[model samples]
Target: MHTLIASPFLDDHLLLRPGSTQGLRIGERRFKELAAANSPCPPWLVDAVGRRWPDLQLAGRRVDEVVLVRQASPFGYGRASYELNLGCNYDCEHCYLALKKFDGLPWPDRKRLLHVMRDAGVLWLQLTGGEPLIDKLFPDVYRLAYELGMMISVSSNGSRLPNRSILDLLTTLRPYRLTISVYGATAESYDSLTRRPGSFAKFQRGLLAAHEAGLPLNLNLIVTQHNAHEHDAMIDMADRLGLPHHVFSNMSPTIYGGAESLPAQSREYLRKRKPFTGCNAGHTFFHVDPHGQASICKVGRDPQIPLLAEGVDGLARLRSIADKLLLRQGGCTGCGLQGTCGTCMPLVTLYRKANAPLASYCQHGPDRRDQQRR
Candidate 1:
């Protein structure tokens, strides 16, 4: 029997059998008793537990035989996201990674990296990209993660799933979730937003193929000024297909640090009305670039640490960076307009570098004292 370790970030202890995807969640006290027994457990479990609680000690000869290893920081992560590649067939106006060059790691390296992530206690692995399906090695990389007992989520534009081989792969692997981005409802509106003449048809074909194959799917309706009018239509399309859909209006700065959607109308429609304090990035979530640079989140301002070079040590650096970024700084600290401010510190820093005024992104304008009073 293998003992499972409890993560401090999590309330329950997850116990697993060797080479199994499923695990049993037990209480912390029970896990401690198991650990004290010094029973043999999977090396990855021991490594994960040790990271979560450094003060833990095990007794008995089995403990002496066990080899302890560390793969990630003490602050264990529950989910990890990898931008499998930066290449896409369609060009969407609201794509934040539009300017990033295609720089996916090779198949062999990607497989190795996945193993490292699995050992680091990442249960849910998200494979995303300009379009993950566009990457030739995505199938092999995905299969390896599945075999490693990691629940996988894929983000795609739904242009490639129509292919027979791709559909077959999905049916076989059966990923935990597949989220497709829907730009517009009609072919004309969709093509306009994607800037690709035939992408709309491709998306339809892909959606049909996925549905036929019984793949678990979700739709993300990206709301931009270009397609805002088609919002209801997009939902109708999802409804027709009997699929769930989510609307995402907020747009972030481009990967190149340019505010692509800073127009007053766009900002006004997408601005948040909350202080936006809660983020799980450095704590239980992280994003890895195609080249293995890890950061707090997809749009976080923390410096990207090279995951390959630093391995789990990179997570420690990420936590530090997150801590620094979370502190209210500059104009954001004690700002009454925070509740209505769309811009955060990271965004402000990006805008500052781009020489764009914060007011351009702020929905409440520069002087909101009257609004606050009201």
Candidate 2:
């Protein structure tokens, strides 16, 4: 039986299991409760409770109550998000990854990254890219992830897939998820977004191949101003293809390929399309640049603090660094959508720079007061 402790210092929504501690600091109320309460519940009961209520709304944000523990993983199963490739093959009019050039990691750095993930007790990883499959090094990286006992998940544009041999290798490697983005409903719409003439066919075949290979598939859809009207079509496509749609609006412009190519999203678009909760970038997850610089999230690149150094001590330093970096000092500071909107600090930086009002890149613009008066 695992004893669970509820912090009276914080709201009842947050709980701490005996072995599993809070990654972030608990509120004062939670701290007091934690101080007074000994282990009052077992792991089994806590797990049961989590199953009954998976998402706990705290501070107006939703987080998974139960963190799934990988039984065979001795390192305790850490979470990591790896930028596998930097180049995107598509040129969608509103493409995010396309704004940047694709840069593949050198073999040495790749190995070091794998070692770091292993040392940090990370068994699950999110492998993202402009288009991971576009790079030949992807298989090698995936192999390295498997060698290090990490369950890999690739977030791709569904543009390319591995051959049978590579697919077989991935099968043996056994990743946790392979998430692909489905951008449009029709070929015209898809190709228009991808900026490729025959890309829709290629992606369709890729999705089929992935499905045939028995890979667990998760589909992503960026609900944009241009595509929002076609939301039902996108959902139907996901359903027909037997994929779960993880839909969301645009991110901050800082994530755009470069500073020069930032796309603007309107505030109205944000209000209509975005979720109420803000982002979990620095709080729940951090971002690592190709140069090995780590920050709370990819939005704001603060060089003062990084998760790891060139070696082992780096891994041990991340959690503390993450703790210190809490409470971002940007767009979210006093924004109405602070907790609900998924905007990050970097996006805020770019947004403020582009428009003083901080109009969301994914939303519509607000009507000016002078115009209203006129």
Candidate 3:
């Protein structure tokens, strides 16, 4: 196992652990020196943070042998998310991925993609999918990414957490965090929502195993019409685990601009979002699909770059693409409320393309504030 990761986090640099949030900020000169392949472990670094990596303080150690030093890149992305595979075990009515097809690059190509992401300066990587934990290459992928020194987080439904092999892998390498989506508080509601018998039982067991194993975990409270009544119960469950939980009450359209998933949304739970402030989607962070297509963000997948073919060099075009896609040149060109619209242009474009009812995303469609249920 590696001691610690020293890497550039955008313009600044950070020194952080694999499974823990504890970190220290360092200067550019220190970062550059540490990044050198043959430099000895700096005594100051050992003195400052040796307790975190006890072996580093034990005399002479080559920087490259113990520490994982991430090289800098012109792309400047600090974070990136990859869909290991779109295949999943459960079939939920509200899933945004319209097609739950099983497909991904082979192991060799997957390894190459990770290296490219590393070279592009992605220090924080998210592995998600229809269900990332079920992917055949999950263990290998996670191991490689961890060895490469990326802080990895897995988004799963929590069904596989109880598996002995899975538990062992996670307990061994450890992840930055596990974000498990909770569909309902009870088995009846959960099984119904997931459309899979015994899913709820497996989920409960998984939670217990993860808690017992001392893994870092969080919860995503998924609220739909079927599970809306148990929202408070879900929160209580998460609170009992002593972990943070977030509520996701809105059902978004499919990635293909299809509106089928919107029907499951809990109307009473719908609330206005913050203003559409600009973001660094294609700049500081980018998203990769199951096939290695790089996009500005999850919602804006079109005009993506094929990372497998073009490699990191393709990311150079992403910023201009983001600028062009975010412009109000289509249906939103003449809208008077464009300035104060709550949603970003790419998301709005999807809703419009789907001919979604205005009440779903448009601010003028209904008085949602009056129906606040929280």
Q: Please, what is the TM-score per model?
A: 0.78, 0.67, 0.93
Where does the lowest 10-residue lDDT sum fall in candidate 3? 365-374
Ranking by TM-score: 3, 1, 2
What is the C-alpha lDDT profile of model 2 across 1-374, one tens digit per residue?
A: 11233322112223343212132334555444434433443343444445644553123221222222212222232466777666777876555444457775687877776776566555456777667776677788887776554556778877677456656765666566788887777787777666788988888888888888777788887655556666679889889977788776554443542433234332234544454344444443555565555555555555334334555344444455545444556534544434444444455555566553444442323433333455
Q: Which candidate's lDDT is highest? A: 3
Lowest lDDT sum, 10 consecutive residues, model 1, at 1-10
How well does candidate 1 score on lDDT at residue 129?
91
**TM-score, prediction 3:** 0.93
Candidate 1: tens digits of C-alpha lDDT, residues 82-160: 9998888877777777574677898877877886677667867899998999888988988787766566888999999
**lDDT of candidate 2?**
0.56
Candidate 1 backbone collisions, by pair: none
- Tell me the alpha-carbon RMSD of every candidate: 7.7, 10.1, 3.8
User: Which residue segments of model 3 deviate by more than 4 Å?
Assistant: 37-40, 50-62, 366-374
Alpha carbon deviation, residue 206, candidate 2 (Å): 0.7
- After superposition of all CA atoms, the RMSD between model 1 and the true structure is 7.7
- Name every residue pair that clashes in candidate 3: none
Runs of candidate 2 with Cα error greater than 4 angstroms are: 1-77, 256-269, 272-284, 304-309, 315-346, 361-374
Query: What does candidate 3's lDDT look like per residue over 23-134, in tens digits?
Result: 8888888888887658667787777677765644634777776678777778899999999998989989899898899998899999999999998999999999989989
